[model samples]
Target: MARGLGATVRRFPAGDLAALEAMLTEAPPGVSKMICMDGVNSMTGNTPNLVAFAALAREHGALLYVDDAHGFGVIGERSATEASPYGHRGNSIVAHAGETYDGIVLVGGFSKAYSSLLAFLAVPTWLKDHLKVAAAPYLFSGPSPIASLATVLSGFDVNAARGDAIRADLHAKTAKVLATTTALRLATPNTSGLPIIELPLANPDDIDGVGHFLFDAGIYVTLAAYPLVPRSEVGFRVQITAANGDDEIDELCTTLRALAERFELQRHAELPAQGRRIGSATPDAEVRLSA
Candidate 1:
């Protein structure tokens, strides 16, 4: 969108808050800035520290734009007596990190958690009023399908009824997969323990063979091949959800063990801790894009 608008974008390396601060400090006068980042990264399944980012945005007079596509209905506000580490209510990472929309613009969709075809933007009232006229999607896109709308409405009901239980189930299933990674001594960039887990291959050239192996094992995964990702980071991603069965998880773990045995996998101890810093930009690593 920034490219479409012909805006000059400056990207900072992921989790480099000091570098971001330097950029903000060195910006030319009269140039509007928007600090865009992810809420919960889709690849590594880690979350940025919204509190710190929000503070920086507020200080710099920039709008903090967050894409929480994978976080909505999964993680939310923390509480003393919450049901699980995922927190209470599926509001999104904005609430999960105990931040507000003061200098923040959160955009997320129902596609991941609710499996619906709707998206949303949580902006200030002034921006909301302006966007009603200036937003391209609002002015140009056709109305959403009736079926999708119905699903969203029903989803709200389901969420209100037993969302916590569903999240708990998801957490348990994800924990099982994480345990498999631990036991196999395979290194993954997943620290938040969210459903999405990426296992980088020791040999990036083996991605095709790995995909084939998983496919033949009756398992499907998102392959991050070279060009799409750097050679060193090429691998596959696994997502565990409440809908997945125990038998399926067992098969996945067994297949992962076999995969480790057949093909060399990156050991957790050998690799340094991945993305330990707060407010990292990339979902997977310290990447800088010019868009």
Candidate 2:
């Protein structure tokens, strides 16, 4: 029988393989269950690595599980990418892997891209029989609620038809925001939609002060500091969506620049030397004697 054990691990950002290699080396022999979040869902935006990792797990005799909540309706050919214009391949890492992972398990929720309160799970045929017989939830729940099921199924159909168009619009809007920020010489990393603009500050108090200033200016952005990131890294997180227009993007950038200037955020100056007078009759020899 299989070991019937599992481990959940996060993939790296920009598809770094060093961490994943280390994880596999450290895992106990005969370990079977492995779970991962599909691209752009976590800190990592890479999806190709997930496919590669899934293949590696299979070779090591482990069952691979993926929660493609963020990828399912947002990536691939039909996603925000320039290549795929239809919604068929949007955010679907497993789908992109083709028939190689025919028996993989996938989980997705509708709360994010669809903005609905529904969840779903897809089990491959090999495990379907086992899930029907051995799965505790399936055994106890009897059947899924009719209303919720209908809503979820309906959402699937709707997304299938229009997902591509929505993703394209989102990408376009995000590009506009990036261009505007770049023109202003702001520190903005190229990302899918979650853009964290680093503020030039040396302390957490400054981050709070900046956040408050933006809020008062009628622009709301998340203030991220230590624990969420690190003490050395502080920034305002901006969530971009298709609904925001070009004008809105421009306004946000303008407001941010104005607020930064108002706070004198960039005007840091070196303090005067201790025990030194700006204008005094004391001779240079007297000042040198202190040393």
Candidate 3:
């Protein structure tokens, strides 16, 4: 793939449109095919600027493909295959249904939001012939296991019926947790149903200490350290679910606040900071007023 793309595989920092544009514009001359994005990109906690990136790729005469594994049922209405409200309008724009963005392809899976193990793809009609001829896996692989297929189909039906109620519960639980965490002065990013809370600790000792403390207190959150995140960004990762009621969330928050107070967690850092700009190398050119 790298050789096919002129021996270069360009990667852009997620959520940065300027960087994505620059990469697309500067890709080696002969490169024509480009895989623009993966499902829910881990780093940015978003789909990475897919809508804008898709337009840019087409302008540059390249093919764009997106894996909607992490976003399919978690984004649009009815959890339709679309970008997170934060990303692009996903499967909504395929050409088959008289939509714009004629040739884009989206790979969907039932694993994340639907909580199933089946996977599927959405491709344009023109590509069907090509896929039949060039796609080796589809041509050579045996039929899907009957029992597994039946179970998956059954799960899909259940998901379609109960999806709304499930999503509502998820949203309520997420909102409760987020509000509680914010009140407790824990830094967390705004997200949809994925209740991932990341707490950045200063060092490995702090990470270990916090993990042990939480475990002893009957709460379990993952401790992540260097290599996973830089040494400077080590912390704990907590995942919440709909099963967590308001009382449980409150308890978790209370426990976190107590721990923070005991450990002297930097609450000030948890609050959002105002943006500032330094004038030049030779100090400030003019006095800046604080808002």
Q: Which candidate leads in lDDT?
A: 1
Candidate 1 weakest ten by summed lDDT: 282-291
Model 3, C-alpha of 154: deviation from truth (Å): 2.9
Tell me the whole-model lDDT of each prediction, alpha carbons only.
0.83, 0.54, 0.55
- Flag the better candidate by TM-score, 1 or 2: 1
Write the residue-wise lDDT of candidate 2 on 125-223 in tens digits: 868888889877779875656776787678678667876667667666655665555554443322233222334444555787788888887777767
TM-score for each prediction?
0.91, 0.67, 0.72
* Candidate 1 global lDDT: 0.83
Instruction: Estimate, for each residue in 1-291, the C-alpha lDDT of model 1 and write its tens digit.
Output: 888797878999766788999999999887888998888888878787677788998999999999999999998877777777787778998888878779789998999999999999999999999999998889999999999999999999998899988988888888888878877878887777789989999998898899999999999999999899888889999988888899999999999999999998677764333243222232223322111
**Models ranked on lDDT:** 1, 3, 2
Query: How many clashing residue pairs appear in each of the predictions shown?
Result: 1, 4, 1
Model 3 misplacement above 4 A: 1-7, 78-101, 135-143, 191-194, 218-220, 262-291
The global Cα lDDT (0 to 1) of model 3 is 0.55
**Winner by lDDT between candidate 2 and candidate 1:** 1
